[model samples]
Target: EVAPQCRTASAAGFFAVAMYYQGADHASFRPLCPAIVEPQHYVREEPLFSSMAAGERRAVRRRRLGWFAHQVHQNSRTLIGGWVTGLFGAIATVPMVARILAPRLTSQIRESMGSLVRPPATELHLERLGNNPGSDPESMGYSLDEMSQIVVRILQDIGMVKDFPPTIVFFGHGSGSLNNPHESAYNCGACSGGRGGPNARAFAMMANDPRVRRRVSQLGIELPDEVRFVGAYHNTCNDDVDYYDLDLLPRSHRELFRGIESDIIETRARNAHERSRRFESAPLGLTPQEALEHVEERAEDLSQARPEYNHATNTLVTVGRRDWSRGLFMDRRAFVTEYDPAVDDKDGHILTRILQAAIPVCGGISLEYYFSTVDVEGYGCGSKLPHNVASMVGVMTGAASDLRPGLSQQMVEIHEPMRILFVIETTAEMLSRIIVENEGIRRMVEGNWVQLAIIDPSNSAIQRYVDGHFEPHLVSDMQLPTVQSSMRWYRGQRDHLGFATIQEPESDQPMNSSESNASAAGALA
Candidate 1:
């Protein structure tokens, strides 16, 4: 019954064998069927798989295990290969992606953070002048008069001040001591008092002086309506002080002036604190605030007691805190003044000394004044004005050019019969210009000799010239004397000599085919 039930199962039926027999005459085989049992009994009975041979069971389990293992291995290999391919692809594309994104990212970051980045500090100092005892020109460790003279000379050399003087604006730093005991001492003389205080008196006097104005006018410099007077005040305690007169200078000079002033104040305070002796006494008597107040009062009294100098109306003072020990000192003034180039001794005074040294050999000069204490340290010698002044002058003069385009035109005319050579590279750009903007080129060409030469290395015309053993003329395209193929043929020379006299086109002569070929060959060559 069990055998029949097993044989009736689908698995048993599928596995049933069909036999084949071979004989001498003919042979045939038929399907072999197993015995069957009742379906009800087979359904009710549990199969005894343990009764099967161990080897057969083992074989079935091995096949199932092998199939599972094969599937796992195949899946792992596919996943690993895909991962590796993706990683490699990403690595290869990184550079291209970075190249596309980097500039845009950088620009965005710069735009976002631009306001936070500080400008580079200026290295310029204003020379100290007048009654303060410590206000020795040498003690500020810089010479202002010398710088002034140098500036004057530069202006003359640049032809900005031919016979007439230019209006000059001077900027200066303060030199005085701070008033607080806890505050550090500084050499900020100009900022000893409050805004519009005594240190600014001298400049005020100069600005208002009719004689000074008349003298300046004679030199050809016209002062603008708004006068600027910038001063650097030292910190009495910890390099923390409000700049009282930052508004004194014109808005144009504010950014640079503020940076310089701040740097000086910080440096001077830092140095003073570094050199100061620490207090050894115990705090048995006064509170910190009281002590601070007491020190500040004493400083204020001292500053008030000091004699004040009379300055011009336009002048404004920036005072350091009261605790500064260096006392009040006046910084140099920025004003428009003219010095006689022939009579001015560059070494005689601070102003003239700089002028003699700074005048360019070419004999014209222009200067921009950047007055700051930082400049004192870096440019302790006299190298301060040239670098900053040149840039300022360029800006100013460039503006002048915009105002009067006729200036360049007139200058061009003055240098006329100017043999301008418009050498076109014979590129697509050149061809386009000749074809599309031919009229403009014609106008330019009419004024000067237009030389058209094939620059494309692959061009037949260029190749022909190269083959002819003639060197191609290496003239600048935009330079004067535009030489074309026709001109070269007319000259009867393969190469145009440098700066030759202009020759008129001959009416009776026509270029022969041989000459044309020779010219083309020479150009190509």
Candidate 2:
């Protein structure tokens, strides 16, 4: 019946392809199948094969699998087999060997390491400047004035001194994953391999105090009585948020807090949907709610290999106002630190302090991903499947391999190895002075470890810094693709997406999945 239908077909570009081996007629019809099509019919247009050798007329160019493809096909099975074998062998032999020599080996191990002396643990000392009140260790705690200054410095650093929101949330981010050896590597680097929740909670507590607010007002900034500060910890792996000090919130502010919480829930669901595109295991057709559930499962799943691609594909770091790059889809690749140039002084002192934290932390993260992607086995800790936690400090390849550092193959799998580009919205002269004044910044910029570019705060004109001079970066005439929303652009795709101007709906009401898909399809058409 299919053969008769194929023979009677009258469509201009109709073709039939074979599937079964037992059908000889289907095999004969394969010659009519199209191998390529016009760009109008196909999603993309590119050559199927390329010349193996360059500048040679008679070079053979057969299609071959990529290195990553080959590894996925061959290396995965071998790694799993080796891991399983090692697991059972250790389980069978280790208990018996320990039982046989438990009494004797304990004495021998202690005697062999008798000369080792543990070093003294260092205690942190916080001393107030312009005061000679302390040779005593007991006077190291921060005073009320010092605490107020800290709050002022934080507000200045983030450029949020004025126009306080009714409900302000300070979110300290970290990761949560089970059965992962390098979990600490995914936490906030600014917190010295620890979660930043404590610091954020402390800051919020201090800022909310009436006494601290009075001191802050005296120092130059004032907080309104209606403004309430909330501290929250964000799990980057699962998109779960935990807010602190909820009981302390006033009854009048409960409704406002609920609204904020709802907004956060929606934001995390959208964020999870975006992250799901990078996970090969995640279905492209997943709804935002389903994507959230998928990531929550990955955090708890023991057999999962890639729990979260931490800091992967990070290439751009923007240090300026949020409005400069607002509505621009960075595809979760840029680390945005909000800073207003108008808030800074003529000497760019505020900008200097912002970059002092931004450059080192963001640059270090980018470099780590760069090196790990370039050489996964050498620079990275290899595959996470075979990793073993050693000494409760680091991960080893197996039971007795050397301690591995850097990122793992699972973490950097989707990463594109490149030096991070730092785009700062400031004048060239101010940035040049900062580079000269700061040695660390100078080394990173001059050594070509990270690329630098400055955008004019007044006109948004960009200048690329090269050889100690600023050159105007040429802008192309091409315009970015416009979409109704980010979900409309990113849905049903699993590759790296480009920048687009998101023209969201003017209404404050949210759209359901069906409405979103219909709008997206209209845009695509």
Candidate 2, which ten residues in sequence have the lowest lDDT sum?
2-11
Q: List, residue by residue over 1-525, the lDDT tens digit for candidate 2.
A: 001100000000110110101111111111111122111110111111232123121211111223445665565479685676566656766534543345234334543563232111111122223343332334333455766876777777666777665666677667877667888778765544445544455566667878878999998999888777776678888889988678778886787677656766887898899999989889999998999988887776656778798688898988777666767788888877766788889999988876766677778889999998999999988898888888877888878899887899888988999999999989999999999999888888999889999999999899999888999999886589999788888888877788888873453446433222110000000
Using Cα atoms with residue i matched to residue i, what is each candidate's TM-score against the true structure? Answer: 0.19, 0.71
- Candidate 1's residue-wise lDDT over 349-448, tens digit each? 3222222221210011111011111132221212211211123222112222211111111111111121212212223333434333334434333432
Output the lDDT of residue 439, model 2: 88
Candidate 2 Cα lDDT to native: 0.65
TM-score of 1: 0.19
Residue 65 of model 1, lDDT score: 62
